[model samples]
Target: MAKAKNDSLFSLIKSLTQTEKRHFRLYVKRSGNTQDVKFIKLFDAMDGMKNYDDKEILKKVPSIKKIQLSNQKAHLYRQILSSLRQYHISQNIDIQLRENLDHAKVLYNKGFYKQALKMLDKTKVLARDTKHFTIALEVMEFEKQIESQYITRSIENRAEILTNEVLDTTDIIKSSHQLSNLTLNLYSLFLKKGYAKNPQEFEEVNTYFQSHLPKVNFDNLTFYEQLYYYQAHVWFNKIVQNFPNVYKHSLAWVKLFQSNPEMIIKQPVHYIKGYRNLLGSLFQLQYYSKFCEVLAEVEALSQDKKVIQNLNTEVLVFQFLYISKINKHFMEGSFDEGVEIIPELTAKLEKYQYKIDPERVLMMYYKIASLYFGSGNYRKAIFYLNQIIFYQDVKLREDIHCFARILNLIAHFEDGQDYHLEYQIKSTFQFIGKMNQQQAVQKEIINFLRITGKITPDQLRDEFIKLYNRLQPLSEDIYERRPFFYLDILSYLESKIKSIPVKLVVQEKFDGLK
Candidate 1:
């Protein structure tokens, strides 16, 4: 029985395209279901529903008995899957390979050993070419079965050949798996700790990566194994804040796919991830020209129906496009341009809210807040930062959460909310302490903001200058620069002292970069 919270069937139905739904309806009708079919009626009712309510479904689809609703929903769900399978048989490589394997089995049962072996050979080639090792192994097993049962002239020394092939393929698959596991661990370390803020954290991640990294001959590795190797290196560099190495390895990862375009077609998800990491490295390096070139290529690939047909890939397309698009503005300090796209970006964020990860959603909120802050709209910035500060979830990205609170405090101060400035400072200080994020930059910001209200207006400029001088060196400190990466406190203070907008100060800095 489906639980009240488990509306997976309804969610799946809601995710279907109009073409898929129409195909499903035609599939049912072609199978001799009448116009008043129970499942069809239920499908129509559920399709039109704004939410999944079992009582509402039963009320609308009177043909379904109350006692049998669960069974009928389950049946419809399986039927939809069946229809999708048939529809995608020609388009999906895994499905086609499996279907071919099933046909080979039929031939074997009908005493056609030669035909079955031939089919297995062809299917094994497809599976191996696509790096579908498990299917390839299964096809090899089928071949071994036929070789034992009946030996044909073409099957001479076939057992020896199959034995060697299986051994080599298994070794490659194991190596790939190990590298992939290392990559995942490195990524987890990155997500939890975020760029190794301290020397100890850096040493920990570096030790783990170096110890677990497989010492394989890169020249002899298969494409998939090599891909994972480069990916592992990319994550290692990213975690240690080695942007140059990140660019080198991530560019290699992207080029591997570009050189093997067929793999891009077969593994669009990996291809998308490669581009994402590449763009991230390029953005960090501020290589705007190359970034724009790659961004355009990704946008073009995303529009190709063949590249983004799967639901997960569809959501990934949006994720990569929006993140890279907004990041371009961030890199150039084009806050006004970033603000212009917030409406569309927010709508897409809400539309794909379920499909996107919460971490990404939170990051977007931070980016939006930063955009507002850069444009001097401190109230709007605080509004978005509050979304992150008040997020009531256990799995929130702790780094973003901590930084959002810091940015919120700065925004309140910049907005001149003097009435509650002391209280905000106290709350932010306590929150940072609770999170155990009392680093040099965090402590300095808290100390400065905590006493802002006590200083008279005549002494405000001197205090701002004093705090700026104290923080300028810390902002340049290799280990203390992480918070400033998110919020440019020095520029804000300089703007306050110079009696100019922070935007102008940021623009002047950006021009110096050019």
Candidate 2:
């Protein structure tokens, strides 16, 4: 396994954009801070290096000894974050609300209860408007604190009003948390093995979901309550392979945001994620035309200055823009055209690599590998599959690793490396055996490969037909259908049985969906 990286200050500095770096410099010099000199030197030195090298920093800056270097780096790290926090307050609503709360606390500490309450009142409005119920509840608590200790005389029946508001907001927060927690669990289940693998797992998921799902009046739910409700449904349906319900809930999730359009700027990441899931459901349902329309919407979102509010939002928008467009090509089976994007997406991924999470990077490699495989470029398919197969984090996504290895084996076979086939088959089988999740699809494929050498060349078509017949029944079995989704093994089999290109077989299916 690759050792975990731990260059906190260097990593943060490397993640900063040029504009952010410039803002940090301006923020530090705003008060003409004299003590900021050495940290600035440290920050500049670390930023200039391609990698974190503290000894080299000491060589470059004689003002710092080895013992103090750690402290200087730590100080610089904090200063960068503080500068970023100040810089992005205007761009991020949560940050702005938080700053307002901090200011209100300062005022309250100075015994200016009225001013603090006033600041919190404004903060409350924005928080509630943006569906930040948790923040709004905090503001309410602070308001109650002030009103309880001193009669502010701010409004009539202040205690009764605060009590009622606090109770109502508390209920809303509780409901939202229950729903969001369910969503988190469902999503974690999906990430673990992609989908429910068998009858037992499906039953367990269904029981867990139905038991944990909180009852709420759909019409009366707060924006966040409604959002989490829909999000939870999306994950549960997706895990159970119910694409139609996935489409239903994902569209509802996106529509909830659209109904609250002003919140889009306040919660760009949520907005972007809603649309991303919508596109995902459309792709799974093979709603190609609708998928294209949603893809265009997200592409436009990626460019919207108002919604691409900050670096985080910018990264998510770009990520989904590429994902939805890639899925668009995928639904169309336009593999060659899709491969055209590999170069540009590659460069952009490298640029935004630090900002992007590792799971997404691994997923991108799998998508790229699938594109190559669909394009009849098995060598390139294997190349990308190797990245996932040898990915350092095996525990991250066990199913994807297994599928990638299976695809790698098939790619080698398709590339006519029969001499390497037996070893590949054995190794892949062992890998699957070691895994906790399994599908009959994998077993059948491995079993077929193990017998391939024993079958005569002329009997290959018959063997392919037999294998297809076996997998076709499993296609109707929900627990056994995962490999169909991940590997598209059925289409490959159909292509082989019919002696046609895989893309053509897939495009024919796409045309029918249209």
Candidate 3:
């Protein structure tokens, strides 16, 4: 009789989803049928078996033969055994999940995420009807670990395959291994899902590629095959650029892709895809040196009469602007060293004929202006600042203010009639006032007027007070604190010019003349 009952209980466990299984256990408990004790112990023991080692786990599996169930609850006993046989599948066993989540209390104590994810992927299908969300949560935690290592693994695997001609056993071991491209596609999806358990993982992957991809050659592979390989390579490399550590990887991938013209011309699909990835990666990396070098490579290669004619214009123009602006910052004669290459970039952008977005172009222009300002090329700086102020649509609030401030300060030092600079300030103030943003612009305006010696000490203080009062209602968003640095300058300048014959004014000073 015990042998028959033991067989029956095992059969019942096979059929239920975790939630249904839990419910059935709860049902047996509530029934108060004293005979159900043996079945309860068996179910409890099996669930407990998940967290322990094989030896320990096997020890926990209850000897169903010993539990003596009351014959009156025979109906419930038969129901369980029948359900297990009909629904449970050994093939879908969640071996890793069982280890991590067998006992709820011990779930996080042994945090072996790598193994845990392997089991959870297999068991997740069973979660459809289960209330064991904790199991899923544990699975998600392990998933972060996997994503963190994914790019690193991809780079490592690609290098090993390309140079050492070795296959990664881990890649082969995954049940989904045959679908390698699909795995990369999954990485892309993982990014979209917005849950990176390891933000640092993205960096590791990038570093591996930046350090390794350039070291290999694809001359051995057919152009199409190389294209396909590099396409995926570039795609993964692009993902790494958003992080600071591996941003350099973006340039590395672009250089690798451009190294062989045959790899692209004979394999347009691969080269085109590689180009797209190159654009994305460079955008994220945002470093200037790599930008210039890779951009030079792009310009040099694009000029070859045999190269693809319709390469992405945004990338071409952006690269041109990137290089052009970068050169603008060098000392006057020193810039000629780099400017020699501008002709080709200009040619490419002109051929493309304004495919770049006006706003993005202006951003590049502003970045260039800053570079020029740092390099002390005041003329170039003024030129780019004018573009940022007059040409760009949808100006960023802070950027416009910063540009205005930089221009005004430069005009003060340069001693030239900066009519454009004066016009920009007036336009900025007009834009601010028309939008009911006068109070927002007041402090900056006060500082500007004070710096140019247009306001007296008492007048500047009263100006700040009026602006403060005007902004009192909307104090939540603005940092209402007066900038002390601004006040300090006002004091120093006030002391120097107190006795000078000058009229102090607080109005908009809309006219161009100071």
Off by over 4 Å in 2: 1-5, 33-36, 151-153, 436-438
Against the hidden true structure, what lDDT does model 3 obtain? 0.42
RMSD of 1: 2.4
lDDT of 2: 0.86
Model 1 TM: 0.94
lDDT of each: 0.86, 0.86, 0.42
Count of backbone collisions in candidate 1: 0
Q: After superposition, how far is residue 285 of candidate 3 from its true place, in Å?
A: 8.9
Model 3 spans with C-alpha error above 4 angstroms: 1-243, 246-263, 266-296, 304-307, 311-318, 321-352, 363-384, 395-405, 416-449, 454-514
Off by over 4 Å in 1: 1-6, 109-114, 145-154
- 1-514 per-residue lDDT for model 3 (tens digits): 2332344444344434576686576556566773546555545554454232323323554343323333312545675654443333332234334543443224324654444444545444344123223444454444444445544342335433332211222222221222335336635543442212134656555564455343234554432233334444544533432334234443343455567644344333334334434543443433345545555665555564344433342354345444444432231223333344445544754544334545445545555554444334667767666765565443343334343444444433343444454555566566645533344435454345435445565675555454444444433332221222111222223323443211121111112121
For candidate 3, report its TM-score: 0.31
Give the per-residue lDDT of model 2 (tens digit) for 46-130. 8888866767899888898899998987888898999999878777788999999999999999999999999999999989877
Error of 1 at 327 (Å): 2.3
Candidate 3 clashing pairs, residues 3+ apart or interchain:
12-80, 12-84, 14-88, 15-84, 15-88, 35-70
For model 2 the TM-score comes to 0.93
